[model samples]
Target: MPKSLVNYRVRHAFLVSYLLIVCTAAVLGASQLQTDPGSITVRFIIFGVIALILMVVGAIMGAVSKKRSASDIGEWNYRKSLLSIREYEKVLGRHEEDFKVFYDDTSSAGGCCCTISAAYLLYLALGIIPEGGIDASFWFTPAATLFIIIGYALLGLTSYGIGQHSVTFGVGDFFVAPDYRGLKHAKMLEDEEALYVKSLVKIGTQDDLQALFETEWRVYLDGQPDTVYIQLKVDKAHIYDYPYLVGIIVNGPDVVERTENLDIDTRFPGIVEYMSDEGVSVLVSRFDIPSDSAELEHEPNITAQEFRKLAKALARRLIKLSTE
Candidate 1:
C-alpha cells in the first residue's frame, strides 16, 4: 500500500503553495515590465489581479487531476506485474472488515487549514495584513478587505479540493490487480477508473462457479455515485446481442430485447453501454450496487457472502457464452 492519504495531502499543499507563489511572482514581474514598468509602490493592484487568475487556474487543474488517467493508474501496473481476479478477490476478503483501514475519509480536507494559515502569513509578509487595521487608504480599504477575504477563502477551498483529488487519483493504488475473470458482462473504457468508486459489486451465479476457475475475463469497476458498472477487456462487437444476452441471463430467460439499446429496468437488473479504444471494444454494464459507500451490500434478502457467490457465477456464465 502507499503512504497514508494525509501524507499526499500535506505534500500537495506545500507543492501548490510554492508553485502559486513562484508563478504569481513571475506573472506580476512580467506584467509590470510590459505595462508601466516603473513605480513599485504598493503593487497590491497587480498582485491581486495575478493572484486571482493563478489561483482560479490552479483550482481548475486540481479538479481535473481528480479525473484518473492512464499515467495515474497505480504502481501495481506502473511497470508492475498483473495478478488474477482470484488473488484480488482474496485480498478483498482479507480486508473485508477493514478494507477502509488503508483509506482515510478525512484526507480530502487535509492541508485545508495549512493552506489557509500559509495564505495569512503570506499576506502579512507582503504588508497586505498590517499590524494596525486596514492596510490601504479609507477609499480602498473595503474593496481590499473584501478581495482579500474572498481570495483567502478560495485558497483554502482550492487546497482542500486538490487534496481530495489526490486521494481520488491515488486510491486505486490500494486496490490493484489485473485479470479479466469478470469481463464478459460489461465493457471497460480508457480512464474508466476516473469514475469514483462508491462500492464494489459482484453478481455471479453458483453453477458456473467451477468454470470461473478457468476463464480469463478481467474485472474492473467504473461509473460514479448511484450507478455501478463493470468493465471487461474484449471486442464486444464480436458478441451478438451482447446486452440482450446478459439481460436474459441475469434478469431471466423472459427478458426482452428492446427495439432500442438495453437499459437498466425498474428492477435495476443491469444495462449495457459500449465504447471502443485503440481497436479494443469495451462494454459498460450496470451490475453495480446502488449505494454511495465502500461497503458491499446485496438485495436486502441475501447475505454478503451469498452475493459474492452470485457474482462469481454470473462471471463464469458470461465468459463461457463469449467463448461460444
Candidate 2:
C-alpha cells in the first residue's frame, strides 16, 4: 500500500477514537447522579482501556510510516532493476523520459497475521501466555514481544521475495526510441509503442557489451533497410551462462550456394552453412560446445584473432561468400 494511504487510514482511526471517547465521557457525566459508584468505576476503566489501545496502535502506524520512507522505496527500485531486464531502457531503444515500469507481487493474504497466531500458540505451549491468556495481554507485555517477532519475520519475507525474481522482461521485449534510429523512424514506430510509460530499472554492470548492444539487437537489426552487419556481443542477457561476446554476421554478401553441417575445427564449434538475397547466406551454429566450455559464447562465423579484425573479417567473408 502507498504510504499516503496508510497514513490517511491511521489518521481517520485516531479521529474516530477521539470522538467516541469525548461522547462517552459526556454521556457518563450526565448519568453519574443516577448510577451507583461501582458501575461508574467499571465504565471509566473500560473507556480508559479503549483509549490506551488506540494509542498503541497509532504508535505502530507511525513506526511503519518511517520504515518505508520515500528514499527507501526509490533506492529499492533502483537496485531491483539491475537483476532482471524489466527495465527496458538498458535493452530497448526508447526515450528514457517516456518509459515507466511497474512491479506487483502481493504477500499471501494474512501472511504475518498467521505468523502472529502461530506465536500465540507457541507461547501457550511454553506457558508464557497462559492457556486463557488471550486477554492477559492488557495486563502483561508478552503480546508485544510476539508482535515484534512477527514484524521482523514479515519484513524478511518481503525482502526475500523482491530479491528472488528481480525482473520479468523476456526474450522479445523491446522499446521504441527515436534515438535508436537516430530519430529517423521515431515517428513511424510511435503507434507501435506501449500503452503505458516504461519504468526505469537497474541493469547490471558486469559486462559493458549488454549495455552497448542489448538482446533487443533484433529490433535494431531488423529496423535497418539495406545494411547487414557483424555483431560480436555477449548473450542477450546478464544472467546467461556465457560471459564473452560471440561473433555473428547478418546479410552475407553472397547467397550460400550450398550447406553442410561440418566440424570446421576439432577444438572450436561447428557451423551450418547455407545462402539468399543479395548473396545472403545464413551461417550460424552447428556444433554443441564441449561440456567443459559449454558456457563459452558460440561464435561460428569467426575465430579468435579474426574477431579483433571484425569489420575486415566480415567484409572478407561477404566478398568470398558472394563472388565464389
Candidate 3:
C-alpha cells in the first residue's frame, strides 16, 4: 500500500451527506408549502436560514481542522521515514503549526448536543409548524416522522464524523508537499548505507579496523544528539556461546546494518563464528562475532541502566584507543 507524505485531510462523506439532508428537507418543505397555499410564513424562512448557517459553520470546521493526532503511526509512519534524530525533531516542531486543532476525539458531547437540537428542530419544522399554520392530518403525519428520523440519522453521522479522528482524506492523502522530510529519508539512508559498506570493506589491517572504529565513534560523538544509535543484541541464554559481547553499533550508515563482517583475518582476528554447544534442541545454533547489524535504534532487551553501563564501557575503550 502506498503511504501519504503530507498532512491534508477531508471528510467528504459527512459533508456530502449533510448537504443531501438539507436539500431534501428544503425540497419536501417547499412541496408542502405549495400544497397548502396559505402556509408560507416568516418562521419557515428563519429555520431555513439558521440551518444554512449551521451547515456552513460545520463545513468550515471540517476544512480547517485536522482529524488525527500528529503522532498517529498509521497515518504518519515516523519509524519507516528513517529520519535522523535532528530531522525527526524538526518534523515534530512543525506539527502544531502544520495541523490546526479544532475538535478533539472526545468531542462527542458537542455531537450529542448537535444531534438533539437537529432532531428537535427537524420535528418542529417538518411537523408542528411546517409553515405558519398546521393541518390536523399533517400533525401526526408519516412524512414528517420519516423526515425527522432521516434528519436525525444524518445529523448524528455528521456530528460523529466531526467529533472523531477516524475520517481520512482518501485521494487527498497524496497531496502532501514535495519537500516533506519523511519522503527524503529513504534517499539519505541509501547514501549513508553506501558509505558504511565502503568503510567496512576498507579495513585491511588491525590498525585500519581501529581507525574505522575511531572514525565512526568520532562522527557520532561530533553529531551528539543528532546521531542514529544502533544496538546489537545477544540472547542472554546464548551470550556465552556468542564469544563477542552484545554491543552498540558505534558507526553504521543506515538505521539497520544487515551486511556480515565475519571474515576472521589479520584485521578482525578474534571475530569468530560459533556454533551453540546446546545440542540439537537450540533454535539458533550459529552466532557471528560482532553479530549482524542491530535492526532497531535500541535492542528491546537492553534496559536504560544496561545502556548507561555499556556507554561508560565504550567511553573507556575509546579513551584508551585515543591515548594509544
Candidate 4:
C-alpha cells in the first residue's frame, strides 16, 4: 500500500484549519473579555468567518489533491516520501504482502488534544475572576464550558479525519495489490529485506498509485518532498521498457517479447505526465515463452564496465525526472 500521504495531508490540513479556528476564537474571546467582557457574540461571528475561510481553503486543497500532486508542498521536498512498509497482518487482514505504509499523522492528534486541554485551563483561570463573580465555580464554569464545547468539537473533527485517512490508505494498498501479485520480475529490483521497494514510485501526496499488471518496474525516489511519485494503473496485459544501462537507454523485455515497448497513459499527471514531459519511456515486451529454451538468454552484450556506464545514463535521467 502506498503511504496514505494524500489523505493524511488532507486530514492534517483540516487539523490546521481547526487549530486556526480555535486559536482565533480563543484570542477573540479573550479580547472581548478585556473590552465589554459580557458579550458572547464574538464566538459566533468571528468563528463563522474563520470557518468560511477554511471551507474555501479546503476546496482549493481538494482541487489540488484531485488535479495536482503532493510533491508541490514545500515542506515535502527534502523529507523522505514513505516512512515504512507494513504487511497485511500489520495493517488490515489482507492476504498478500507487498503493500507499504505511505503517510500517517496520528501523532498530531496528541498535540491537538493537549492544546485543547491547556486552552480550557487557561480560559477557566481567566473566567474565575470575572466581574460580578460570586461563586468560585460559577466564574470558571462558563469558561470551562465554552472551552470544552469548542475543544471537543475541534479534537473530534481532527481525530475522525485522521482515522478516516488511515483507513483509506490501508484499503488502497489492497486495491492495487491484486493487480500486482505474482507479476514482478527481475532480481535486481529487490531490497535487503527482499521487499522490492523500488518497484513502487510516488508522484505526490495527493493521489494513490493505481496497480497495473505485474512487470519489472524500477522506482527512483530519494525522499525529497519536491518529488512526487506518479502512479499509473499498469494494464494486466502489456509489455514494458525500463532503464538498465547508460547508453542502453532502451532495453528488452527480450526474455519474452520480440520488441520492447512501454505504454503508459501519458495524459495523466503522476508518472505518465512526468515521463512524457521528460521524454522518458519504459519499455516491456510481451511475456511470451521462447520456444528455443537455449536461445532465451537475458544477458546484455556488454562488459561489466560498459554495463555500469550504461546504467549511469539511465540513472541521470531518473534523477532528473525524480526531482522534476
Scored by lDDT, the top model is 1
lDDT of 4 by residue, 170-278 (tens): 3223234332432232222333221223333232222333322232233333442323221212332223222232111122111211232223222211111112223
The best candidate by TM-score is 2
TM-score of each: 0.27, 0.31, 0.28, 0.26
Instruction: Give the C-alpha lDDT of model 1.
Output: 0.38
Query: Candidate 2's error at 316, in angstroms?
Result: 2.9
Query: Over the stretch 1-324, how does candidate 2's per-residue lDDT look in tens digits?
Result: 233212345445544554454345434433441343234353233323332333334334433433332222221111323212234533443323222221222244246445544643443333323245434333234343343333333333333333222332221223222123211212222233221112223332221212222222211122323233232223323332221222233444544346444434334444444455453454432234445444656533333332223223333444354344
Model 2 compared with the native: what TM-score?
Answer: 0.31
Tell me the tens digit of each residue's lDDT in model 3 across 1-324: 111323333445545656666666556554554454334353344244534454445544443343432223233221123334354345433442333232123335566556656764764465436446456355334554455345434553454445344334333422232222222222232223211110111111121111100011111222223222222222333332221122222232222222223322222222212122222111111233344335324333333333333333433333332332
Model 1 TM-score, all chains together: 0.27
Count of clashing pairs, candidate 3: 0
Model 4 ranges with Cα > 4 A deviation: 1-25, 46-324
